[model samples]
Target: MGFDFLEWLNLAARWLHLITGIAWIGSSFYFVWLDNNLERPGSDAEAAGVSGQLWSVHGGGFYHNQKYPVGPGQLPRNLHWFKYEAYFTWLSGFSLLVLVYYVGARSFLIDPAKAALEVDDATALGITSLIVSWLFYHNACRLLARWPLALGIVWFGYLVGAAAFLESVFASRGAYLHVGAIIGTAMVGNVFFVIIPNQRKVVAAIKAGEAVDPKLGAQGKQRSVHNNYMTLPVLLIMISHHYPMTYGAQRPWLVLALLGATGIAIRHIFNVRHRNGPTGRWIALAVVLALVSVTYVSMEKSGAPAAQASVDPDAISFADVQPIIEQHCTSCHAEQPTSELFSEPPLGLKLENFEEVHAASTKVKQMAVDSDAMPLGNMTGMTDEERATLGAWIDAGDPE
Candidate 1:
């Protein structure tokens, strides 16, 4: 068999992205938990510049962790940095984005129904969004440094607006992924531009026997906390493509906003709980937000009805819809896909025959009928009428 270079390259980048993302997010969560759980240091330890400490047992060994408010009295000969994980994660993730979305823009990024963007324009827009998002977030942080509550509200509003704008231009899945990429960029920017630089300054000061600036430590802590809160939302966006119900909804941007809010609220509950704070109210809020998101996405929209009410269920049959499937779906869903996008049927679904199509009736109804999520960017130009016909067939129990 011949080698598939692009496929292997895509897999390698995705694998690296997953590995580094875990490392980066794991460290962020651990540090946040450790900081919240730390107890005040004893008098002697405080005198030696230790602010807080924690003791824990793991793998039959005990470990004690210490935090210095500014910098330790003396810099350690060897210090560990958590920057590379964030850097490499961003690199690999951007590589996958370019490989899967930009390179295959016609098949994955552009939706003619949304915007008739050429390949070059779509790729440029995606790249520009990343840069512009980071600039806006960074500047907002600096502008509202003294008022954290205002900064958070503004940031959340900006994200919602971005989701709406992206959904208007790019394909729904592409829009959702770009939102995730934007947030990820801001997170890594915090580590590279804010947190690490502040640490290095403090280290230099301590080594030179100069007093460290307290603001530097406070700034780093603020950004770290922000990263911790954002982790859950970004995680959900990463795997969202597999479940079309989210990005396929009538108002996909609203669904994204509501779900993102749910994730943030849930993340807040853990942060509050870790600090030994009462989490009853936050937990309640999170539950409510989650239910709202689920309900909103489940609602049927006007254009994309669940089934065609005018069509007689008894009249539609497998024979009537077989031609529609052949025209719009078989290219990618058959046992031997003719589409260049896949060597095998996507998700291992082969719908060239009645049995296979019937078995996947629900998925077809969801992706093709209820939402324009299939045909990958509407590459085969599947029509609204055709989708309704498919919906009617499935509703009629997919009669043969």
Candidate 2:
């Protein structure tokens, strides 16, 4: 139950990540709709390829907005950078990812049966893939963006490749977790590399009263758009671990891909919502149901889909884990654990027998995972040795 400084820091990071992600995503989605809905004003200013305009009331004030194809002229001296939300959101998210998944990877990421590597190797591969993914994506964006649909083709190939690689080497959980990390890394890098630099250059031009190049803005916008498309999927990735129902299933990577695609498509519905209203609503719903169908269809995969990894009651024996559990865990886990002075199982958990033990392997793994609570009050002074025995038991195919 007691937590160290780093564990506490992780808690704080998760809180901040959620707060800032909401703000960032809210603004991003809002701006997309705003851009789509702005009305065209055929004035002299309209000759400059200005597509639309809008008037709004908020905070007891009226606001007017305009859309220029690119640069209208020199940038404003009072430019407010919209880059911080992207940066802070990514920063807190990265910290949480490192804390929950990386540092705790032995408990969270490694799958011995699936991949015979130490925690360090899994962590290394995760980090390397994330960094390399960004580099590959950035370069490919710049290089092939001219071909119009090149981004889609490359993205599709990369997604399929990533799913295949993950399925080959790691368990379903490991593969999906890494996908989110990949996208999160790319989002942060977009801020530190492309978005910020271009904004700085544009600001410099504005300060010098020189003409701001339109291409700079275009490049930054393109990257931002990419981030927008990624937002929904990254969110699913972040929370996937908590839902064993999703990542624990068979063919989890396939689930990840379909869910991710649905995210992108759903974003388009919102992107055009302001312009098309109810029509856009249908598109978003259609994609959502299609995604649900993907998951449902996979469920009919003859019992080997990702999640039914077998609840073989015989697999995880009560003997190996029971004594260890009783020694440390039963103090609080029992119907009335003498160690904790409780009248009932802490979370109504009764790991008192083989049945209870196998049924709660997922919960056991989760608790043993973060060391959130067990051996209530450390009454029996459960050592790391005992924790490992329990964790590894679950990881070892949770065999009986």
Candidate 3:
């Protein structure tokens, strides 16, 4: 197999992104769970400035953790900061975005069917949208600091609106990916611009033997809470490239909104579960219901009708379909793709033969016919009639 430098670069960046993302999310989850499970301290611990504490057993050992509402009288000798994970995650992720979308804007970023944009224009729009989103979120946090729930609802609406707007201007895949990128940018920005800076102020004050400003800690905690809630949704967006149904729908923005709500609700259940919150079960049920609704709607909108014209599978021979595949798909899905971006067939699914076509009938229908996600930005200009023929062939059970 040949090697593509760009593809290797993407793999390296994606690997780091996943690793750092896991570290960052794992820490956030542990802290949130610890906060919820802490119990009020005893008199002695209270005298020592401990507001709450928790005891747990893990790995055949007991673990005790204590929380100080403010800073302790003295700083600990060793303090490990959690900021690098967030930083690296954003850095690696942004690297991947530039490599995949910006560099290959013509094939992966712009959709002529959506909007007539030059490659430069689409890349500019994607970059600008991320910056604008961060500015809006930062301002919203400061202005609506007192009403977090309200701020969350309003921001959620902003995201939905952004998705709607982007889907109109970008390729469906690129649009969904941008939404995810926006959220990732905000999460890291919260850490870099707000959470870490506020935390530093609190620490500096504590180190200098001055009373720490309570607002600094409060602001940091608020952003931390927001980050925790956003974790699940961001994960969904990161992996959305592989799933066509979520981004390929007629109203992909609506699909994103519903799926996002489901993720938040699921996260909420976990956030409260340790505290024996009564709403966990209810939220889980909501997630199940929301998923069902999304699945039903997606299938209703994209799945071929039962009455679609039938074809005689025997008549639909490999000879009839070879030209279409060669023209539209073989560029990237061949043993040695002519496309420089791919060193080998994408997903190892070569389409050079009838056997390969028959083997991938299901994927062909899903991506090309049903979702219009294949040909990666319609680079090959696969016609409507071609899609119709492929669909009929697949529906007839891919006979010989």
Q: Write candidate 2's Cα lDDT for 115-135 as tens digits.
A: 776777877888788888888
| TM-scores, one per candidate | 0.96, 0.74, 0.94
Candidate 3: residue pairs that collide:
none
Cα lDDT of model 3 by residue, 239-303, tens digit: 88788887877778888888888889888888778788888576867668597757866676756
Q: Which candidate tops TM-score?
A: 1
Candidate 2: Cα lDDT at 178: 78
- The lDDT values for all models are 0.91, 0.70, 0.86
**Winner on TM-score (1 vs 3):** 1
- By summed lDDT, the worst window of 10 consecutive residues in model 1 runs over 302-311
RMSD to the hidden true structure, all candidates: 1.6, 7.7, 2.1
Error of 3 at 369 (Å): 1.2
Backbone clashes in each candidate structure, one number apiece? 0, 10, 0
Kindly indicate the candidate among 1 and 2 with the higher lDDT: 1
